[model samples]
Each structure stands twice: as structure tokens, then as C-alpha cells.
Target: MAQSGRTNSVSISHRSTLFVIPKWYNSATFPKDIMRDNISRREGLLMHNKMLFVRPDKPITSVKNNSIRYSGWTYVGSANLSESAWGRLVLDRATTKPKLNCRNWECGVVIPIRHNDEEKSSYIPSTRGITTSVAESGGGNTSAGSDDGSRVASVFEPTVPVPMKVPAQRYHGRDRPFFYMED
Candidate 1:
């Protein structure tokens, strides 16, 4: 397929992206999204061209130094490491095994924010420019509890106690079971 005008391009308009970076690059503080005109088509097939960039304008400035895709990444089985090794964990809620209880390997969903692993931000900060911490957010407890410096509270939250009324006309007699229902 002879393609023209297919140069790597990115613009900050109305769009979402999931910028996956490796641990090594993540340490150096690189923004997940390519913040410059560095989209290079290192390889790919047909109309599906692969993009390569570490701030592509500055390949030397990668937040993660290793490969992002799963095929090239190492496969540590769902054992040995009880806690997930950062991005090494793929979360699955249905897993009975504790080791594999990390972030789920979701398919084709866009992320809301691009995290710069080297720096941190506060949630509605008094001032927005403080690089304070990395990934230490709770689900915002609506109920009070003793903070024993434990993660048991974050692992699960108490279900909202408010009475949720099921709209009668919403289902309309179609007996399609809920998503979790199984035959």
C-alpha cells in the first residue's frame, strides 16, 4: 500500500490517549503523551503504522526506557511477587489468587490523564505546582474510619448506603440478566 502524507502527527484537540511507558523511562520523569513533534514510524504494516517516540522530538527523553507492548515485555507468572511490581501487574477482579490482583488488562479504553511518574500532583491543590508524591490516592472515604496505615480500606469501600431505586420503566419487561449473571 503506497501511502503519502502519512507523516506522524499529533495535536492536542478533543481526543484521549493511553500512553504506556516502561519502568526505566518512567523513572526519568517523562510525560506519557508525546509532548512534541516526535512521532516516528519506526515500523508497522499497511495503513496500520506503528508510532515511536519518547517525547518523540526528544527520543533521549523517555519516561520509560523499555518496550511498552506485551509481546516484548517480560512475562512474570501470577506468583512469586505478592504485590504487583508497578506496571508489571495486570488487574483482574475475578481472580481468586492474590498475586495477580493488579490493574486489569483492559482492551482499547482511553485513559483520562497522562501521569508523569517522575513527578506528582495533588487533587485540587492549594497551589498546583508541587511535585509531592506518586499514586497515593484513596477512593475518598465517605464514612469515617481509623487510618491504621493499612491498605485494607483502599482494597474495598463500603457500598453506598443510600437507597437506590430501580426505575420500573427502565427494564421494560426484557429479561436480560445483569452483566454478572451466568447460566
Candidate 2:
């Protein structure tokens, strides 16, 4: 979910959490008011631009007494969080109707992390730059067990090394996020 406003003005409910991941630059020379606001309000973290990983602590289960549950999800692509990239609903001037107006060509894939009913384990979807595991002792080692001794496994092995720092960094007071048109 995205919003265009100050961080303090937005109120997130207890049932939902928000994560804001913005682009990172090497020189760290641009003005990053957005990142600074997010950090001041404790609303966001810095992550890689090429990849996104979302692992919920608790799985979302079905409400109809079914065994199905969703562990997590991942999004990888070229779409940035913008109206032109994701499209915006606008009223058509000629037709008096509402339509989605997108100015840019963007594409992305959202892969859902599924819970394996047959194996009774959580299947974490692996990506190019993220290390995902559910180890037995909660250590960094890759294993096929959860902290509670339940079986857990990766659906696919991570093919590439992580490009950025693990456990994404928070913006300090002096830190700044890069802007493309900054002069």
C-alpha cells in the first residue's frame, strides 16, 4: 500500500503493517526528505531496488475451516511505486467515465508463498538475491526445520548472491536517499 503524505499524519491499524522501501545510491549525496520522514516516524527501511522480500511472521490462513494458508509473497520487476508505473484512476474528460491512466510501461511478477498441505510444511519462495530459510535452531544455517521443530523447506534454491546489505538499513538523521533529477 502506498500513500502520498507525511508519515506522522498516517495511522496504521494494529492488524496491518507498512513497509516503505526506496531506491539507494552509492554516493548518498541527494536530499532524501521522504526517507528522512519515514525514518523519523519509524515507517520504513532501505532495500535493494532490484528485489523485494516480504515474509510475514504469521501465516494468513483460510477462514472456512480449510487447511489452506498463505505464508508470504515476493514481488520482482521494474515497476516503481508511482502513478505512472502502477497506473492511476482518472475521470475521462470525454466520456465522463473513470479509467486507469498509465504513462509508463511497467511489468512485475507477484509470487505467492504457498503452504504445502501434503508435506505439512511452509514453502518459502526463493529469489535471486535473498537467502530464505526456516532452520531448526533459528540459526543462519540453511536447514529444513522451523524453530519449533516443524518441517520447513525452500521451494527453490537462491540462484544469486545478495546484491545489497542484508537486514536493510534505516535512514539516519544525516543520511539521504538519492533522487534522479537532483542537481
Top TM-score prediction, candidate number: 2
Give candidate 1's total backbone clashes. Answer: 10
User: In model 2, what are the clashing residue pairs, if there are any?
Assistant: none
Q: Where does model 2 exceed 4 Å of error?
A: 1-49, 55-57, 62-65, 91-98, 115-163
Task: Give the alpha carbon lDDT tens digit for every residue of 51-97 in model 1.
Answer: 11011111122246453211011112222221333334454567744
Per-prediction TM-score: 0.15, 0.42
The residue pairs found clashing in candidate 1 are 25-63, 25-64, 25-65, 26-63, 26-64, 38-56, 38-57, 91-102, 91-103, 91-104
Q: Which lDDT value does model 1 have at 49?
A: 19
- Writing each residue's lDDT as its tens digit, candidate 2 over 29-136 gives 633322311121134332325444444445668687467775555666897655657789989999999999877887787776665465344444332223332112
Score each candidate by Cα lDDT: 0.22, 0.41
State residue 69's C-alpha deviation in candidate 1, in Å.
Answer: 22
Sliding window of 10 residues with minimal summed lDDT for model 2: 33-42
